[model samples]
Target: MFRHVKSNLLLFLLFFSGRIVHAQSRAVSLAEALQFAQQNQLTVHNKQYNVQVNEARLRQEKAARYPEISGAFDMRYNQQLPTVILPGEFRNLPAQNIPVVFGTKYAATAALEGNYAVFDPERKYNTGKAKLQENISRNELLVAQTDLALEVRKAYYACLLNHKKIKLTLGNLGRSETFLRNTQTLFQNGQVQPVDVDRAQFDVQSQQAELQKATLNLNQNLLSLKYQMGFPLDSAIVLTDTLLLSGERQAVFLPDELKVEARPEYRNLQLQQEQENLLLTRNRHNALPTLRLYGYYGSQAFREKFNFTNTTEKWYPVSYFGAELNWLLFQGFLRRAQVQESKIALKIRHNELLIFERDYVFQTYSKLLAMQTEQQNVHVREANVQLAEKILNVTRIRFENSLVQSQEVTDAANDLLEAQTSYLNALYDFILARLEYERIQGK
Candidate 1:
């Protein structure tokens, strides 16, 4: 009995868990989709990592301004001692040359060295450029995030449009099936011919085929949306947001003038220009000398035997501190070449910034115009859909009263489907254009 109860409890838990999973698969809104994509998209995450890496580089550059300390422990054994010549005048052996082997057979050195740049133009420029580069990386991340959001939004809109098309197709399918039934009933009453029933049946089959196509298209679009959001393709998602074809656009919410500098691309270009300028300055200053301070404090031990543990052995202390000034008088014109290259690159970036501004303006205005046209088109298409729906309804009633033929009802259903599809397309176009405009504006 205990075993049976345990088995039943396991099955109950499994069923309850399945229900929880199903319930968790609720609808997602546009805002939620965009937020989720920004958080999870691989492209955005990679860009974020780039920002972090640059931040670390910035820290490294900043730390370069401080003193560098290092240590080394070296041991050497002399298999054959080196010989050196010495003057014997100090020993009252005038004009005599003496050869002597010096020092112990085994020697070891342990030292700590310190170096600080008193004034290095390269280091100074490096820190500045690193700061600028870090900012540029952050801006790049922003650009990635913006691009991801745009893609996710477009996918979401496509899914919504597809869903609407499927709904319309289903409705038309139902109508066609109903018409077929009515025609068959009329045939039974001897009011319609067999040809009318066959035609109605054909219309129903056509609608079913269309519904199948629409359903497949919807599935394809949903997969694209999931890919954009970095969501699992095997998971199901239902959009909670609906498109309103006749709704007003939010263009008035935007500023009249586009802020070109507000764009991440433009900001990156500006930073590049600044970094290049710093490079040029550094190259020019390369002609000047570099100043540094260096110090070494260490002790060296020497013994006849290899044993370092001998307490009787003496370790000599060595210490030195000095400032150095190194002047590279010339570099075979490499410095000049670098300066010239920097100038050319800076000029190129300047031109690029200008070109970007011009192009951005052009794109923004073009999208604005397209958005306006699509907005107008949406209203027109919406009106057509409503008219088509009315015509379908009227045709159905007339057919039931034996006033219209089966072909007329089929044509009405086709008309309604076409109008709805066109309406959805217009809405999709308008929303996309509006989104593009916002993106170009760097909003």
Candidate 2:
């Protein structure tokens, strides 16, 4: 009996542990969602890596200005040593010439060498260009993050809107069910015809279908929101935010002078233009002379046998230091072509920057106007929903008293649903427009 109890206890513990392994539903606010997206989004990570790459490039460019040093070791074995012809007078044999070997059969050399650019016009410009490229990459990352924040806000609002819609549809369904129940009671009392009962039942079924659709839409929106937040798709999530219709209204004032510099794209383009200018300078300087300081120290040994361990064996040392000046007199017109290309690129970027500035101002103005219009529409739709709700209640009461037809009650219900839907749409649109306006203004 003890053994049986032990087995049962083990089974119970396993079952409990399995349940504990399942993750609980997470409740997230809009701010928390945006934070998660910023930290985990793939695009943000990619942009961050791009910034890192440019940083590394900048470091490389800076390092290039420093001296370089290297070491080398070499060994050679000659089966047949090289020989040179010697005149006979050297050997006291007049009018005669003989060939004699001069070098040992084995030779080895060790060397330490270094080179430094003492004067290079292009290095300075190139380093500056690398720094500008790094800045451009950083700005691009900022642009990505800003765009993601706006997307998260929009998706969060969409989910809220859909959730409210589901609630509205469920309320409508409840009302239809109640109306159906009341109509059946009236028919039983001989106060209403069977056709009235049938109509009420039809309304209930239609409302049920509508509720189902609304629920599906809410779920879809929730999934999309999770995707944007980089949250687990299979995990349950509870949005801890409530839609406050009255609190959504805020005063917005457009700036008299738009600051294009506040926008990352504008800064990125500006940096790109600067980079192009530096490239042009570098290309123009490429035709100039380059001066470098170089030196090497080496030791060589030659032996007829493998006797490197012999302390008495002498190794010859050679060293030299000198400055070299290199002037690229010609390169098939490559430097000139590069300079012209860079000049053209700079001109193109300058024009593009101008166009972007104008377009940014225009777009900001347009978004502000649209946001105001949507805000106004939200108010109008709110009023319409209130009126529709009142009409629905009146119609339902009149139908109960046999003063209105079943069709009239159905029409009122439909109008109320439509009004609610319109209000939700207007609210979402206003939120979207406001978010866009803030983004455009670089707020």
Per-model lDDT: 0.84, 0.84
TM-score of each: 0.86, 0.88
lDDT of 2 by residue, 302-357 (tens): 99998876879999998999999999899999998998999999999999899999
Predicted candidate 1 versus true structure: per-residue lDDT over 1-443, tens digit per residue: 34335434643664485467558775789999999899989988998898899899999999999999999999999988999988988687989988888877999999999999999998988899888888988998999888888898889888878777767776776676667777778889999889888877777667666766876787798899999999988888878887643235433434348799878889988988898899899989999899999999999998888888787878899999999999999799999999999999999999999999999989888888888888878879989998998998898889889898878877887788789879888888888888888888888
lDDT of 1: 0.84
lDDT of model 2, residue 361: 90
For candidate 2, the clash count comes to 0
lDDT of 2 at 131: 90
Candidate whose TM-score is highest: 2
- After superposition, the stretches of candidate 2 with alpha carbons farther than 4 Å from their true spots are 1-23, 87-97, 250-257
**For residue 218, what is the lDDT in candidate 2?**
70
Candidate with maximal lDDT: 2
Q: Give the number of colliding residue pairs in candidate 1.
A: 0
Candidate 2: pairs in clash: none
